[model samples]
Target: METAALNPVELEIARNRLESISEEVGTALIQTSYSPNIKDRRDCSAGIYGPDGMLISQAEHIPLHLGLMPTMIKNALATYGADRLVEGDVLITNNPYLGGSHLPDMCVITPVFWQDELIAVVANMAHHVDVGGITPGSMATHATEIFQEGVRVPPVKLFSQGTLRQELLSVMLANIRTQDKTRGDIMAQVAANRLGERRIHELLEEWGAERFAQSTHALVGYAARRTRAAIEQLPDGTGTFTDSLEHDGNQQRDVAITVTVEVSGDELFVDFIATDDQVDGAVNCSWAVTEGCVAYVIKLLTDPTLPSNAGLMEPISVTTREGSLVAAKFPAPVANGNIQTSQRIVDALLGAFHEFAPEQVPAASSGSMSIMTIGGFDETTGQYFSYVETYGGGQGAMPDQDGASAIHTHMTNTRNTPCEVIEREYPLRVEAYQIAENTGGDGRYRGGDGLIRHLTLTRGKAQVVAGTSRVTTAPWGLAGGADGKPGSVIRHGPDGDEHRESMTRFEVQAGEGITIQTAGGGGYGSSPAAE
Candidate 1:
């Protein structure tokens, strides 16, 4: 049952079936989750992997999650060999050094067995609101090491032999800020994996076990062939480019991430050996995240329409130096790397590709995630509240079309929390929410405009932590276009004073308001054409 024997019709059917299982897993998690971040914003991802730890199919959710999941699965398999994985056993991990993006993003892996033989592993990753840290959100902006960020769970069994590990679960719940929400979200992820197992079993039953195995191989091979053909079409040469992070989250200094993209024959190589050393701040990222960024950019460049699997990455290779910004070593603070540095890696890749194909590349988008977290205790309700959300910004203009306005671009795909929901859930008032006027750069195709959000604390005191970028080094334009406006975070006291801070944590009293102006995207070309 080799891949070469499978016909095109069988391959397409098999590919769709495998992808649908992953999609169904994500749908179940979203519908059953309690938090708005997962239920409404959909910050989770699901995927199916082969028995040999190769990615088979994934849902079109978070690119960061989908890309790093395969490595996490392989690491899990390496830690506890296949002989140790039993039916109804679930493995969990969030250690960045051990194939995780960040502490808050927990990866859940469950093996599916058919006739007592391991068939596949269904896995899902969800960004929990809190996992215990100095800050309420568990994503500390000023953390100098990984220990201060959150609980770093290594590869371990969360469920064993069809029974929940109550002690382990209790330890997890005891460490986080939001116990009920975290527990509910984790259980939802568990349920999603269970559903994935059932769906995979159904798929195996429909197609004979041997046929299913052969089809999976054939589909992956087909995708690899298609990607190689696409890569062969590009010009063969080395294109080197560099991009920067606005700050290291601890100071106003910049950290550079460089990429040298080489397209030789039918294969592509991305090397990050010359990037800056890992910083002490939360801006550093793990090697898994850097690999995810490269895989995602390659997928986007070669053929986005191709089915996502290990085969798509077959013709691509990524190299990163140890302890570098793109491949930080153990103990490096990396909470913001998953959110902020991941975006810069993509930008660097795009920059490298732009050297050969400028028309195919758009100007820079709102490069930062515009992260803001507000946590405090409410006297009226006699309880505590912690709210974490990322605001959207302008998207870069394309060659022929204008960039989308006030939207999440590139790495992150989460939606902004609606003002109605924010006011209803937290002790705050939405003073104003609108698109910033004249924020987008001017060009033949104008870049998108950023958003302006004004929030006022209603009662009690609140701690605000903002980890945003693209303020000092604004999004760059191309082909003579002007750069976009820089972003800013301003604190307006109840009386009259206004203060500016880009990346810092501060306290706010009742009646104080904060204004966030997200950066706009760069334009494509300098022309006074109708936009």
Candidate 2:
């Protein structure tokens, strides 16, 4: 596949240049987006792909987004062949069956052309605030079907021949609750892709197409070689483990997600056949998410610093039962799958890897994103509002150091919405935000502590929907370390009474409040029993 020979030094420079372009695209999306989900929380990702739909470089964004980006690109290419994609043409999609995490994560694809020859594809995925659903925030916990979650967008041309599809845009905006912000966020993604297109064209002009292709091929090969070397260091055996979701929200039953990782020679295989069948709730995930989770853990174990591209996944193979919870079929609600089940997949992978490489894998993180959404009307403004948030809990302890506290770990890498911003935007008051004491597991190096966020409604009625897990099964410890405390969502009524709830949707009257207590990381290393 070597079109032209390039030395190692030259290859490194080219790699950095491509990666820098992706980083710039990500920055453009964040700076231009209007929603706090994209702007403040930074729930977005950007990447550059080759003409054949292979990921070349990506920005340091959400792991779930980056890992599944290639699939998204390939699906577009397959639906509308490469010959159909011309300069100034862009594709938009959030179809869960076609390489999408959920409906809210809209992906924009633009083909970069130089001298009328297609050279690359620049794409980005951003979590829109709303896409028209029964729920206010579009994250319905009890959604039994995909249609109940949000609007479903297949791979379609949002822009064709340098012209905006105004009709298409208008229709999409008409369905969602937050039309203005959603429109801004979509255009922001377009802007990011356009910027990436210009940068790629400039790179091609500077180095010529042959040199650019040669350097990218060389860079991918280098990453593959590094990953293979890392894989060869591990023992040849199979490690199996099982972790679970306490409840799927549809029924009050535990859902187990199991994995068996096989490492042989320079190849690694991850199988998810031991998991439970897909439930009728919103926790089921598409196959793309399951594959992405496998690829993510392999990268974590082998060479996290290696170039994040398709080549790094060359030696890894994934297998999943078609109708399992981790690989759910069509029409299954997956609103919480991407955020909640994805975390449990990582935990299962870590559990398996701990069998042979305990030092390489950290103990379980707070095994949930702790999603909390409160939506209601602001009588002061006479407009409907939905406040959606995912809180960071404790990070699992490492063998050499203590875990980090109050941080987003694995799959999710988003910034927190400030207390001031939440209160300013919504009719809510920041009652108390503090670190929950005695939450982390005790060990030689204790796990990090979780946090508590208590918010009170200033006025009007509201509906609270929470999608969370790890309430019954605590984040497990390693090497005899103690287990961390379980997390819970508590409602403090107007009469001063409090109670715990799980995956629930209820009404909150004025003066009522809710408190979210996230879980802490499990400790690492053997220690005596705690008093």
Candidate 3:
């Protein structure tokens, strides 16, 4: 299985084929999914991994999901040994402590076999709408422990040798609020993995297992060389920066996140050991998530065209303190950590990188996902319905170009759920959806404007959970630019307008509505007028 015999052209072709397989898997999942979260918003990711759980290639999907997939698959494989896994078996898990971002994000893994030998594995993860929690949506802002957030599923066999585990599936669906959507999405994941398996088998048929393995090994090594070369371009330096979370749902404010980046030779080291301890609310993220955020910033700073495989991570090393905000322990609530904290982590890292490479970094963006979840009984359908969505915000402005307005930036890459879909599916109405005027900071290159979305209950009463950031601490500006405007949430009801906290859970009546105003991005440089 020596890769020395493989030529550059052949290796490039193999790389493209593998990447296409991952992209095809993602397409299959989105097309077959039942929930709007996956079908319309495309909040899902797919990847192909080697037999040893090393990432080979991934689709250009969510950055957060792509980086964490390798860790999740490796954990699953370690939990359930290869001897226990069969050809058609699919493993599932959403335990944050066990290498997952949150409880709602479910990962499905399938092992590909060639003549009784395990050669590769394909996996996909999707954010299910709801998974049995104290609140209607699984992301409870006030939830202090993981038990209250949602149903926790550890690494287990969802399918055994092409047979679905009916009893286990039944138990899982019984706990979730949107049973049909969850079930359908799970099946869609299975379908995606199945397609990946079939495609890999086709490749193995064309080229023997030995050649296939050799090509994959060669691709990974090539990516490693490219990443190291990119790192060598940066001057050796150490940069440190600190950022804070305005509030963690449980009244804790200014939860600090510190990062120190060191570039030596062709290697990079990111240390988060100085970060604050885990809080009492749902703002805590696991070590895998912290690593994912660091990996994302590394890719952006180094080379965006680098192949997204395990090799890309070879020249980078990350260290985080155990039980810290960026590396929470078991039993800590983490629903918002994946969406909210991840954004802040990216901002902190970029801020540190700016110290050494100011031209390479951009001003901070809206720095929030603006997640909104509403759930209750649907009068029209006579069933329970839960809707979950992450609203896009201002994108950070670059040195030479203006930022994009009302777009998903940094860690998230999801689309906004269409207004028509919300009105047609759930007991809610999209009263208004537009960009916040003049919100982006003014400079040589202005930052992007934030979004304003207002939603009203259409029929029955519903419970709403919203988590946001950059409310108290505005998105920071760089290179003498101005700070972006902060965000705010309000409830418009019979009692008039009432401001809400950064993280809050409330009930809304049929006539009541909620309005979310996201933060804008920081400017890149001082405006000509100011100059």
Candidate 4:
């Protein structure tokens, strides 16, 4: 069938329509989810992919989740061949080795069919609060192996031929502590993907199969051309930088992450072969996450307005060592790696870019996600409760302006869980929530200030996990700027206040409280005082 060519106006319309569908899908997931992590913090992502598993459109959600969606879909298709997937078959998985960032992040994928032909796949990923791990949340700081993180779900059919797989769901829920919440969130993900499937079918019907395929092809090609053009603006050269994680839960030693970025003609190459080996802690990320970080930085530096799809990565190449921290092997604990190591990867890559494009790249941000999780049994409700959240810190200063205060940066784009929601859902109270005054680095354009959050166990005992970074090593500055302040976690109990490591898990009794202070951002230029 010959397809009609799309004019610029028609192409733009198609792009907006597809992007809007993804956004709508995300909104549905958020509104229907049962956990605070998904509904309140919006810790979820949605995207549409081609039949061959290439990303077509995505919601402006978490960068880490959005980047890894295509990989997850590809792995699912590989396991259950596209030819074998029926129209109503919905697949699910959260295996890091199988293209997932972590175990808690569950991926729900549904194939979209038109006229009995597989046209595309609509998918969404949501972070479940508890998935039956050693800790309250699945992101245990001391987890040394993948088995200890949470229940690992490989690519399998959650719904076949429009029927729910009750046995499969029962086996999954049996392992989770907060089974009701997890079950609700999982169904919400299914509903979101179903909505996406309907929207895609409507789009295909309106545009016709031939025109729809042609328009999508045109959209991807346009993104590729724009990305290549942006790369062409850069001078051909190679730049290198190294950054480190303060600790990996099990040890206080630093884990190094190194990157070398090469710009040639109209192409960009990123190499992480010099990075350190995977350690015994939970700070090692998989290759999918490494690719996500690289793609994020490239899109950020190149053209923020370009359509986000597989085409944007056409001019980019990323290479990582098989057993390195950026590309860990099986059995490696990777709960915190998804949140912490990914941030450091962005910092290192941006530092390397700063060497050549000093004017274009800003200084480093907080370089930490500052994740905290608390889980306990609620006597009043006769239910198990798990609370998980990532606090925002300082955003790095730009060349012409100051950094933003207490905001999610880089790979993470989630909002802070509201205090009311926290107190109502968990056996904890928000004692203090404010900005740490003067924590930002001083420069021509000062860096942003970090946040201070204090939470006290309201009743009974609870388990707490603090997974963070930027304690031993601070966010680096560019030009003549100064490094940002490091982060810290403290416990206030009957024995007085004790400091915690970058990644630690502990038990807190009633009346005891925990304080989390995130890291500040790096300054852009030297201050007058230093001059």
TM-scores for every candidate against the unseen true structure? 0.97, 0.97, 0.99, 0.98
- Model 3 lDDT, residue 457, Cα: 95
How would the candidate models be sorted by lDDT, starting from the highest? Answer: 3, 4, 2, 1
Model 3, range 97-182, lDDT digits (tens) per residue? 87789999999999999999999999999999999999887989888899998789988899998899999999998889899899
Q: Which is superior by lDDT, 1 or 3?
A: 3
Ranking, TM-score, top scorer first: 3, 4, 2, 1
Model 1 residue runs over 4 Å out of place are: 379-382, 495-497, 529-531
The models' CA-based lDDT, in order, is: 0.85, 0.86, 0.90, 0.89
Residue-by-residue lDDT tens digits, candidate 4, 302-340: 778878888888888999999899999999989999789
- What does candidate 1's lDDT look like per residue over 329-353, in tens digits? 9889998897789988988888898
Tens digits of lDDT, candidate 2, 1-531: 753666778878888999999999999999999888888999999999999888899999999998888888888778878889888999999988877888888999999988888888999999887787878888887898899988898888999988999999998988887777888899999999999999998898798887778877877888888888889988787899999898896766789999999899999999999899998889998878988888788878767887888888888898899889988889888888987999999999999988877778888889988888888767788777778788899988888778888888888888888899898888788898888888998898889998899988888988888777777779988887778888888888856756655577777887888988889999988764551
Error of 2 at 320 (Å): 0.9
Candidate 4 matches the true fold with a TM-score of 0.98
Q: lDDT score, residue 6, model 3? A: 69
Name the 10 consecutive residues with the lowest summed lDDT in model 2: 494-503
